[model samples]
Target chain A: MDQILTNALGELLTPMTAAYALAAIGLAMHFGFTGLLNFGQAAYMLVGAYAFAMSTLAGLGLIPAILISFAASIVLSFILGIPTLRLRSDYLAIVTIAAAEIMRFIVSTTGLNDVTGGPQGLSGFARDFYAINPFPAGEYGFWAWTMDEKGLWVRVVAWSLVIIAALFVAKMIRSPWGRVIKGIREDEDAVRSLGKNVYSYKMQSLIIGGMLGTLAGIVFVLPRAVQPGNFGTGLTFFIWTILLLGGAATVLGPIIGSMIFWVLLSLTDGLLSAGVDSGVITFITQNQIGGIRFMLVGLGLMLLVIFRPQGIFGNKKELYFNG
Target chain B: MANEIAKGKAEPGCAKVDPILVADNVVRQFGGLTAVDVKHVEIPRGQITALIGPNGAGKTTFFNLLTGFDKPNSGNWVFNGKELAGVPSFKVARLGMVRTFQLTKALSLLTVMENMRLGYQNQKGENPLAAMFRSVWKKQEQVITETANELLVRFKLDAKKDDFAASLSGGQRKLLEMARALMTKPTMIMLDEPMAGVNPALTQSLLDHIKDLKKEGMTVLFVEHDMHMVRHISDWVIVMAEGKIVAEGPPKEVMKNPAVIDAYLGAHHDSDLGSKKKAGK
Candidate 1:
């Protein structure tokens, strides 16, 4: 039991976990607050990573690179939103997913190999970020877990960014601006009559959320390398799962949901692998358990949607108008 | 640019108090039907004008057309003397005109106060770049809250400030919509069926609030069903039937007009007959 707890804690505290939480926060802003079904969070993250990486390679400092990445994400959001945002909700969802897939294909094309590394991925570029680590040269740990100086630094900076972003989101939702987003989510026509440009507000929401998603992408690849495979449709699905696991519209829901989701996955994987090795589950092999875990999780999610569509922290009223 | 020139020429003066809104030869065609065919109408500034008609009389459709929620097949609308024929809904709103919905389009998930805040125009944090600065947003938040509180208190909805809009009673939702419309500090406010589904206790208060809108120098255009409320509050009443304006005058005078009685009350008589027959079975 303690071993499982230790492993879960280790997984939750990883920089990757913070990155997922941050991206999920952005997703929550898009889908939860504004009720925009953005199934293309991964595309924003990818653009952010590529833009930052390319700018860094061009000798731009960290701040300038980050700014450039944000600008790139905003431009991409506009391109996706212009024709699609004016359409129906379901159409927007379809366009966003296709756009994400298109982005992945473009990055994987051999013609862009020099820039995107043709799926071999980009590394050594993050060394500039690591060079400024404030941690001393030693391993840090609690109980049977530990992290080296670089790992500790990544976790600290990643979580700090997440916290700052979360605070910014928290404040915006409470302000008049947040109200407009919620207004659009409810009845855009009514909002329009109020002399509010519903499309403009929606575009703003998409850009802000996309920028955050891109920031998450940078954090995602910072601790290790930027791999094209990591920014796929699966990443977007995982973010949806995180947003739903917590209350979608609640401020802290995504952060807590991300923690719970990782912990549960780790626990399930550990238990299922143990079962397979002990021959208690003779119907499945250790390698096949990977697929089985996801299936089992899928079942759990189905049950959650059936019984409590609003998830643990979500208010049922928030789910009343699904746009 | 044409709209700007048109607006400059129509500036309010002693020669004529330029109507804040003009719907001329507006027609909305829904497939094989003309939902609204308003030949000519004017909503003067700082006056309360009521739009009353029977159900399916195309009152809502006319509101939609004038506000840019739905495009008219052929028509032109001017707000504050500016032609708003092709202007989108949001830009129209930003031009000092705001409206509410008949179905009470209060954002269900947001709290009552939050709904009021959403009505403010040109929000700073709405810009993605302005989001990073906490102090700037915080200042705006305070202003929104203070103003929301004042509006809530006036609407007698202060106690429900923290509750989600979904929790409000039907009449309360109506109040919330009116209160929220004021958040824009609009020069003109249009409401779709402000009294529909409202409790009797709130009926008088809702009328008073609509009256208060004019008291505060805002022009009010509303679609209503209740003849009594319209007569009680409205300075002018425009009546529509079969998608066209059948009558327009002071509320008391329009109600007595033969065309209004025939187009509106005559239609109600038929519906009432059908309903009575069904009940007989």
Candidate 2:
């Protein structure tokens, strides 16, 4: 029982949790504050992961690779935003869903095998990042939380970025600039009549949110590999689930929401597998554990929406369903 | 005020004594329907001009065209001596002509104060980078807030300053929209059916507020369906039918025009509805 509990708690420190939290913040910006229907946040993540990895392979070093990934996310945001931002909000949702899928298929195609490694994906790009690790060549943490030097380094970097991003987004939503963005969220025509360049503000918002997704993508691959299969419509939907689970619009919602989602996921995984191994659960095999866990997550999300649509941190009076 | 507004006899497509807005050959067509087609029209400066018509008379369409909310198929308009043929709505607003929607857009999630502050153009802190630093726009933000507070008080919305605009009553939302427009310090204002959903008690105050706008030296042009409102407050009135300006004159004169009556009622209003009319008659 203690092992199961510790294992679930360990999910809180995983780089994947940090990535989901980071990308969900970007979704909060797009859907929560600005009223942008950006369903392809995973596209930005894919762009970031691929750009950072490819640039690193090209010998651009760490900082330059990060910058290159940011540039790539900006470009992708433009490609997604320029035509659809001016139209109805639904157009963006439609475009993004399709765009993310197409990009995934393109990346996975054998045509780009040499550059993107096709289905196999890329690795060895983390060397430069791990090279700068200052935690020394020894294990760290206490009890079940113990990790090598690189694990600690990536955790510190990922959570640091998350903190910076949260602070930045919090400060922005309280500023005059955020006022206009919120106004656009309510009514673009209303904002336009007030002498605001609504299109420009929307574009700016898209770029900012996309950059966060890109950064999350980099952190996502820091302890793993840059795999095209990781960024799909499923990934985008998961980020959304995290965003809504935490609460939309508020900065802290995604961070805490991601933590809860991962913990529950790993907890259910541990419990179900233990049940299977002990022969206490004869209905499902070990291979079906992953699918059952996801089903449980879906059930939990539906319950959350039905009971608390405003989410945990959200004000009960200010329901997110207004838009 | 009515006598001084027109240079020639007050008629459809006539010249104004001092035109603040002039349009020539503005046309808008939606498939088989020609929604609006005005050869010439001019809005007089520093006066209350009411655009009135029955439903489907294209009053709102013309308003949308003049304010740059919708594009015309042909022709151009000049506002405050600047050609606004292809200018975007925001630039048109920045050029001192602002308009309110028929359906009041109160920006529901925003606080009443935030909605009011959004009316101020060109805030330094509106820039994304500049917004990160409080010192950059802190002083100006305070000033803007002060201005917004004054407007709120004038509009009797001071009590709800921090409340979300969605919480306001329908009449209050209309007032909020008008007050927000005033935040731009516009040279001219256009209101589209400001009294549509408002209750009778608020009607008189809304009228008084509009009259107050004229006293403040701002050009006021509004679209209203209530003939009583057109007669009570408008210095001049322009009537439309079938996407054409059918009559234009001082409110009293235009109200009495035969064309105006023909437009409101059918051409054979004199004939009883039960009596069938001859097609060629």
Candidate 3:
């Protein structure tokens, strides 16, 4: 019981939670603020992770690897945006989803097995990052809530990135450019008539959001092995759920949403697994707990959609998902 | 150039003053149907010129063509002596011509003041790098805000400056659209039905605002069906029927012309005089 409680509480501060929060904030910029339907956010993460890992493996330093990753995300955004930005929002969504799938497939293919490690994935890229960690080697935390030096370092870096990204995005949305993006979301024709280059704004939005997703991807792989399977369509859907759960347009919504999502997920998993072990819920085996947890979250999301579709942080009047 | 000389002759298609917009052989067709087939037309500078036509006379379509909102099938137009063939709407606006929509396109999600700020040209805050640092565009933003507030006060929208554009009444939206357009400090303002859907109480104020544009040394071109409003404010009137210009002159003279009467009243000669008297009043 103590182990279950500790794990559930600890999940809130994990690097994975921070990564999802960052990615979801990026999605909020794309869908909530700009009215751009970018269904391939996972592709940005994949590209970022692979680019960072590959560059690092090829003898590039940490800063260079991170820069290359951001550049890769920008190139990916251009490829996706150039053809689809001029069309309806749905075209971007379609192209993005397909592009993400293609990227995952490419990384997982046998042709790139030597470099990407195929389905097996890549590791040992975080040694330099871990070497620079200022945290001393020890389990740090009060009472039952403890994290190792590596875990503490990853969490600090990841959460810092999330906070910085959120602040940056908040400032942007309040700026003159942010006004144009929100305007485009409402009506591109009106923005264009006002002498704003709508295509250029949309492209800029795509690239910025993609770059943030890449940053999230870098943090996501820092504490774990880089794997193509981790950045599937399910990952994108999870990010969307986090974004919608908090508040699609609000700065802090994604962070709060991610924390809640992970906590709920772990809590349910722990409870269900314990219930099965105790023979209190004999109908389902322990293996089914993962599926059941997802089902429970889905049900909660449905309730949220029905009751408050604008999300916890978003204003009801500002809810514009039509694009 | 032939049309310039034709102006003094009181010909059907002519401009009596210095022309700002010149359209030649401009045609826009929707499948087999010709929406606008203007052969030649010139709009005078620094005057409130009203483009009046009966329903389905292609007045709005002509406005769309000249403003670069829609392409003409076969036509070339010049604004301020510069050829504007294949220019995009934003570029057209940048080149000193801006337009408002028939159905107000005020961004509903944005605040009234934010909508006004959107009209200011060449905002440094719009640049990605410049946007990150507040100090870079902060002064310009303040200048834009002051300008926006001033316009809002002039348009009587200062009280609702913080309100969402969606929350405004229909007439208020129209006023906001016009005020927002002025933020660009445009040379030519093309309004598409500025009085449409507006309450009668606000109609006179809108008319005064239209007249003010001309007084400010900015050319004003508008499409309106209300003959009374057209005659009350417009210095020049251009009449269109069946996708072609049928008459052009001073409002009082053009309103009484037989071709203009026939196009509007549909061959009813007796009712023409009666409607003309009512329009002239």
Candidate 4:
């Protein structure tokens, strides 16, 4: 039990967890604040990843490449948001999913094999980003858990970016502009009559949320080589699940949700696999572990929704009827 | 009828005021239904005016058109002489004309204080760049909090200051909406069904607050169905039915006018049978 707990704690502290948390935070803004059903958060992530990787591949420096990627994500958000965000809520969900899938297809196409590396993806592109690491090489952790120099660096940068983005979101929600967005979420007609451009505000919210999703993508591939398969619909669903697990419309919700999600996933996987191998449970094979773990997670989510639709720490009042 | 009122001696109380908003032959059509067809309606500056009509009388529709919430098919409306027939809602608010919805549109997710903060104009922290200097905005927030506190106290909503707007009762929500509309510091305040769904106990205070709007030199245009309240606080009354203005004059005269009576009492005679039986008691 102690070993399993230590192993889970080590995984929890990884940079990948931070990146996932950031992406989930962005989704929280889109779905929670604006009541936008964006099911293609992974597409935004793909664009961010591809943009950063491609820019670096094209010989751009680290910081410039990252900034360029962020910009690219914003442009993509507009493109994805324009036709869909103007229409019904379901349209946004449909279009976002299609957009994400389209991005995945484009990134994996043979026509762009030279730059995107087709399905193989880009490697050594994150080296420039990692080059500025201030952390010295040493195992850092207490007890049975420790992360090396590179792992430590990734965690530091990833969590730092997440914190900064989360803080910005919190402040923006407090501002007048934030109020207008929330108003649109509840009733666009009321806000429109107040002389606000409803479409423009929705577009802005989508773009901002998408850009955050993109930031998550960049953070994700920072710890490892960029891979096309990573940015999938399943990834988007996982982010949504994380967002739901934590309270949506909360700054700390996504961060906490992502951590809990990954921890649970790892915990369930470890316990089930250990049980199967040690003969404590004989019905499941090692090959079936992945699917079973997700099923368990899904059941947990179902129960959560049944009892507490506002997530673990969410205010129920925030869960009003979406206009 | 309007011409007759104009020919008569202008009432000494609020008749001599200048007109600040004019709806000239405004028309809104939804397929075969004509919601509002107001013609030659003028809102006197610094006076509380009531727009009374029966259910489906098009009072709200007219309010929507005036505030730029809904576009008129044909007509012209000018606020302070500026043509506002096609302006958007937020821009209208920014132009010193703010309105409240019949069903209070308070952001349910936000705390009452936060909703009040959103109502305030001239907040420099709305810019994405200004987020770093949140301290600067903090002072502005303090002013906003103080102002919100004062307004909340006036409305008797100070106790629920930290609660979510969703947690408020229907009457409290109405008060919050009115308070929010004031945040924009608009010269003209248009309220849609301000008295509807409000408590009878709160009605007098709400009416007094509305009268205070006129005292403070803010033009008020409200659509109401409560005839008693309408006659009491309204400086002038404009009656609408099936889209057109049937009568416009001082409350006493407008209430007695045949057209205005027909629009409310005559048209709803059958529907009022149920209520009249109860009222007879």
Q: Give the best candidate by lDDT.
A: 2
What interface RMSD, in Å and to 1 decimal, does model 1 have?
A: 2.5
The lDDT values for all models are: 0.82, 0.92, 0.90, 0.81
Off by over 4 Å in 1: A1-5, A57-61, A134-137, A306-308, A315-323, B1-18, B121-146, B265-281
Q: Model 2: how far is B210 from its true place, Å?
A: 0.7
> Which candidate has the top score in DockQ?
2
The TM-score of candidate 3's chain A against the true chain A comes to 0.97
iRMSD (1 decimal) for each model: 2.5, 1.3, 2.2, 2.8
Q: lDDT per residue, candidate 3, A91-182, as tens digits?
A: 99999999999999989998888999899888889888999999989999875457899988998999999999999999999888899999
The CAPRI class of candidate 2 is medium
Alpha-carbon error at B34 in model 1, in Å? 2.5
* lDDT of candidate 2 at residue B160, scale 0 to 100: 99
Which of candidates 2 and 3 reaches a greater TM-score?
2
CA error at residue B228 for candidate 4, angstroms: 0.6
TM-score preference between candidates 1 and 2, better one: 2
For candidate 4 chain B, the 10 contiguous residues with the lowest summed lDDT are: B7-16
Order of models, best lDDT first: 2, 3, 1, 4
Model 2 agreement with the true structure over A1-323: per-residue lDDT tens digits: 78989999999988899999999999999999999999999999999899999999888889999999998898898899999998999999999999999999998899999999899999998889988888889989987688888899999999999999999999888999999999999999999999999999999999998999999999999899988889988899999999999999889999999999999999999999999999999999999999999999999999999999888888776763363
TM-score for model 3? 0.94
Tell me how each candidate scores on DockQ against the true complex.
Answer: 0.43, 0.77, 0.53, 0.33
Cα lDDT for residue B48, candidate 3: 86
Q: What is the lDDT of residue A275 in candidate 4?
A: 92
